[model samples]
Target: MKAKTHAEEAAAFIKDDARTHWHDETLWHVRSNRDRSAQGIPEWETLRDTASATKNYVLSHLGELLEQFEANAKANGVEVLWARDDKEHNEHVYRILQENKVSNIVKSKSILTEECGLNHYLEKKGYDVVDTDLGERIIQFAKQTPSHIVLPAIHLKKQDIGEIFHDHIGTKKGASDPNYLTEAARQHLRKKFVEANAAITGVNFGIAETGGFVVCTNEGNADMGTHLADVHIACMGIEKLIPRAADLGVFLRLLARSATGQSITNYSSHFHRPAKGKKLYIILVDNGRTAQLGREDFKNSLKCIRCGACMNTCPIYRRSGGHSYNYTVPGPIGSILSPGRDLKQYSTLPFASTLCGSCSDVCPVKINIHEQLYKWRQVITENTNVDKSKQLSMKVAGMTFGKPVLYDLAGKMARTALKITPKSLVYSSLNVWGKHRDLPEVPKESFKEWFKKNRKQ
Candidate 1:
């Protein structure tokens, strides 16, 4: 079966008017809260600058820092492993579980694992894996991948979650209260936490200087799972490292504020060493990150802190929904990153923007998201096989735009057509641009003609 493009998926999402509006408003609310929180801090911009600069330094010295981090982590009794890609990362994780002789696993929110399809891989190997994060668990029950990176189940409503819980976790048929549902989830996950043979967590920051990593979460599920399980496995991309422990202060300040408008995550648990009689493992996975770092135009995208601020502030993303992007991470940032991994599959993603620049404006780490999106579009057009209609149109547009006389004639012809053409013909299937919007009212005369006439007066 042919895969649906981003536009097709987004059209389906927009068909549900109420849900689409609610999704847009809810994300905009988060974006508004982010703005308010950022405004409260006097040095918010400074923090963003510092974080971006720090990440830039890390990218430049990534190999040296990773080595330093591994040495210090081993000194602290933590085992360090490296994986060139997703397959190796999953194998390393499975091998650890196999070596520990465990089958049941409880995991906190880990986008890296999701990117690698770790849960599916482990389940196929006969190991039971449970996602303990509330949003993650919700989506897991729904058998859907995360829509928004930070808010995994942002596409789901309280009513939708209540129904899912009733079906899976045996909640009341119509229970929709936030507190009630939260307590029910806590009770359910408590048993999983207690019985978990191993716990997996995603790393928010890995300090090269100290070899300690931080996992920030409002629910403290990562802390609970890791503390209870005998084996703690942390998965991180190579870009998660910072040069010094102090660098954490800058990122920590920017992350929570940009993500959920909190001053800080409720728990910022740091793991430098394993608890006595327990095992700690860190998997540093490359998975195309090295290639991305080598791309001069897109290396800055690696600096993303996974805050989802870009997603929140993107008007196109707000209207289209994250699932439309069909990538592990979605929205403006994903549009740029996805094409680098698989250009043919994700060629349309880069064009999924208005080039509004709001995404870059809201990014905590100051990644040039909108600019990169534009750059990716240019690259896609030059390298990929674009549609014949689009190609011909662009060629005609190029010729017309390059010649002043042809440009003026085309403008006059368009105005005349708009004045005489029926709405039905103007907004036909062929006119994709006018499908959802009305053309502006045509003026009686072209601006050039009016200017020429008035200048003589």
Candidate 2:
């Protein structure tokens, strides 16, 4: 929140060169593991293509599919709720809790809830909501949003978390050992799971054919919470629908391996019907997703299965921590998605990428993330009310580019100025790009000049 642009915030992370390198290498290692797992599967690309096709089908037939899902789910004794937006979604959840007379709830990892700001909204409304996922629980206690959607606390060092746990949950001071801290969190969260009167989970995929929803997790917390609670609620974006149960085979194959290098999550739960003697609700949320669907360039974003592979492969994301992007879902996909929601606040996001396209290569669902980022940049720059400086700079570049003679002259002048400029002034406040990075030396000749001399044209 303190940093306005991606560059400004990414600078803070880069200043600690050691931590930045560690973050970069850590994610690169995850990417390597993904490659290893993907190599073992002969049909990985085929699966990706099929997944994309499946999502395309669902997006095209969402209304019909969702109505079938609703009818089938009701026949199976599950109540279905449709929320048009975040405000209505949160209000629906609040009303459900009030109906159940429950003030305390245990929730598994759900970025949809985070997107809706439901935890904060419910807390302000006097209900106690406990995040059960280890990463979500850590960030929740820290009073911070998830740095990464899948690995929510990736930005926090174990030591930083040690300090937090020591203050909030009474871990021994200076105890940052992974096994010890995990055990402590386990003991603490186990009690909450038992005491919570209601539970919530995010749907990984909603099956229209069977009226069932899948919630995949490395931890078995979703099952534990739902089975223990009297009221269970599952929240999902309308985009999660995939039409049939057999389609899970393709997605489940790609999800965990791309996400964290596991063959699959330790738990791939199918909530076909509510737990015995318990009430269940599924809130199908349409939070600007319909609008995003209307955008042909960006509609592929809805195909994302939340595998987080794109985040691992993105060079910019690896160097700049997730918090740098200042969105619920950070990295390449987030950059493309956030601008559609709030252009004024998130206009900087689409420009955060280097257009490397590694994200599209690694996506489980083939979102074409880097292409979308590039497209979003064009859209935001042309359509949004951008700043005066950006407008003026674009205008100057456009005019100069339109005239070959002027461009050549301008290039010569820039090279001369760089050669003559004082070192102090070159790195001073006047040079924004050079403030954090050293300026490159001007070449003796431009490419055009070199080509002309070499070819004797």
- Highest TM-score: give the candidate number: 1
Give me the displacement of residue 320 in model 1, in angstroms: 1.4
Q: In order, what lDDT does every prediction score? A: 0.94, 0.91
lDDT of 1 by residue, 347-387 (tens): 99999999989999999889999899999999999999999
Instruction: Put down candidate 2 lDDT per residue, 1-457, tens digits, no spaces.
Output: 4438887788887899889888899899999999999999999999989999999899899999999999999988999999999999999999999998996799999999999999999999998899999999999999999978888988788999999999989999999999999999999999999899999999999999989999998889999999899999999999999898899999999999999888889999998787678899999999999999999999989998998899998989999999899888999999988988988789899888889889999999888888898898898888878889979999999999999998999999999998998999888887788766787879888998899889964
Tell me the spans in candidate 1 whose CA falls farther than 4 Å from its real position.
Answer: 444-457
Task: Note the clash tally of each candidate.
Answer: 0, 0
